[model samples]
Target chain A: MHEMGIALEIHRVCREAVAGRGPGRIEKVRVAVGELSAIEPDLLRFAWEAVTRETTDEGAALEIEWHRTEQVCPSCGPVPDRAPGTWLRLCPSCGGPLELRGGTELEVLDLVFAAEDDPPGPGGDEPGEESA
Target chain B: MSSDERDGRRVTRDFVRIRKSALAANDRVAGELRDRFRDAGTLVLNLVSAPGSGKTTLLEQTVRRLRDELSLGVLEGDVATELDAERIRALGVPARQIVTGGACHLESRIVRRALEEAEFPPLDILFIENVGNLVCPTSYDLGEDFKVALVSVPEGDDKPFKYPGIFRRALIAVVTKVDLLPHFSFDLDRVRERVATLNPAARFVAVSSTTGEGVDAWCDLLREALAAKREGRPWP
Candidate 1:
């Protein structure tokens, strides 16, 4: 799946986002994947697990905020959605052509990082850094 | 280790907000390349389609039709083999084959690499024939003036409807092998309607590379794009 490449790119974005933040575990990354972006969320999450498996971000959660590209009939304006991906062939209100609006988003919104006040350890501070 | 929230030894959790494109780097490179192409007076077209959709044949015919009038080049992307490049080279156009080694899409950086390494004499039009696949290629921008999605008659007309991602992204939707329309159940009108519903701005062009039918219109569109590029105008 191309989502593998996209996941690598997302990881790169995540790295850049948390760059120079000192030693820390990136606990989570939040991103918005649009319906029209052509990225499969499940596939991306699967790929993320692979990319971040042994890295600092291992077991990091990828929260996907899905967005829909709603279709708008040019003449009638903002038509309500019938389904997420399916579009009405023609404008229900107006006979004009239906155009899509703003759903091609593929962005990294934010991330959660847990910085170590002491030093780098075997595991993260959450799971096992403070072991028994 | 954290012994409650008492000491400074506690783990500090911070939420960092870095809102940016997943392809911010690729987008930056693509923007730079677009400027470069604009300054050099070249119309770059990223042709994307399913494999065996007559992209190579269409490119060959496109070159033959306008080669004398335009200095054209092709950066052919394939998952493997130089076969597509070889085919284009037979038509006397400078074709650089970019073997992605199983990468589904040609990223902007790869195009940048191809541009740096390859020598194409001041091209009027450079067609980056993307590795055959609709889904992945739709995500990566290779600094093309526009993307063209092609689907052959044999592939069925519902392809535009099926793959709305590519259809929505493409400025032009081409239906190849209309000559085979008699043999297939593909409906051109339905394709147009479906594509219009998804991408109202996507101009549809039906062509048959075998019959040379509608090739002129396709070349005309290219010429129009070239004129637009030179005039610093948008494609009409």
Candidate 2:
């Protein structure tokens, strides 16, 4: 599925953030997946593990926070928050058509790495290591 | 660090958790595509629908009809086959087929390349006939000015309600193959009402490419969208 692509993006972002930190292994990478984004978190996590297996971030934990798109009823205002994976048609409070508000987001937030204390950087590669 | 007193197997560090969205990169790419379309004066329409929704047929007829009035370029997306592209080219419009190579939907990256391969020409409209899928394409932004979702009569009157995500995201809902209504059990009003509920602002145009029915109004809608872009106004 498209989760591979999304996992690739997550890998790209994590790589950029932890680049040149000196052979340090990534601990976890946090990503937010919106309900309307058409991305399945389980598949994305599976893809992440497969993608990062040979990379520096191997065995890294992928923390996915699922976000829901708020569907506000024009007549009733905001719909009540329900458990994840629940679908609602009509407004529970008022019988009004629901309007989607948000939750179609997919973003890589931050990267946590185990930066080894080796006199400044990872393996002492200070900024510009070996060219080529 | 009162680990032993807390009766814990191992004291896990209380790391600060930050919640964020992952679509920032996609949004960035989408933003750039929007700018490029604006600069090129390209009105990109991402046509989405289920299989057999008459997307390619509509493009073929539209290209043939508006060949004299505007410069048209078509980007047809499918898992395999250049047949749609061939059909468009047979109409003499600048068209290219993007075989998604098993992808269910066309992402924005493919479209960005298609625009580049088209020489980034100054065009009136760029029709991106997305992979004939109702579910997947609704989530992916193909860098289009607006999305047009097709619901054919053969699909059933409950199509809109069953797949609200696509219709809700689309700006225009085109009910195609209306000529088949006589033989099909389709309620036009119920479909229209469902679509209206999802996207109240979206406009609906019912047409039949086979019978040449209601095409003028559809063509008029297309003209109005382009004209709105030309006048620096919001497209209807």
Runs of candidate 1 exceeding 4 Å displacement: A74-77, A119-132, B1-9
Q: How does candidate 1 score on lDDT?
A: 0.87
Any residue pairs clashing in model 1, and if so which? none
CAPRI quality level assigned to candidate 2 from its DockQ score: incorrect
Lowest lDDT sum, 10 consecutive residues, model 1 chain B, at: B1-10
Most lDDT-accurate candidate:
1
Candidate 2 lDDT over residue span B32-138, tens digit each: 99888888787889999999999999887788789899988899999999999999988888888899999888887788787677663467999999998887787
Q: Write the per-residue lDDT of candidate 2 for residues A61-103, one digit (tens) a residue.
A: 9988777777688887877766554445678987777777766
lDDT of 1 by residue, B1-236 (tens): 22223234556677788899998888999999999999899999999999999999999999999988889999999999999999989989898999999898999999999988887889999999999998999988889999999999999987986788899988888999999998988899999888877777788899999999999999988898899889989885
- The 0-to-1 C-alpha lDDT of every candidate, in the order given, reads 0.87, 0.78
Model 2: DockQ vs. true structure:
0.15
Error of 1 at A114 (Å): 0.6
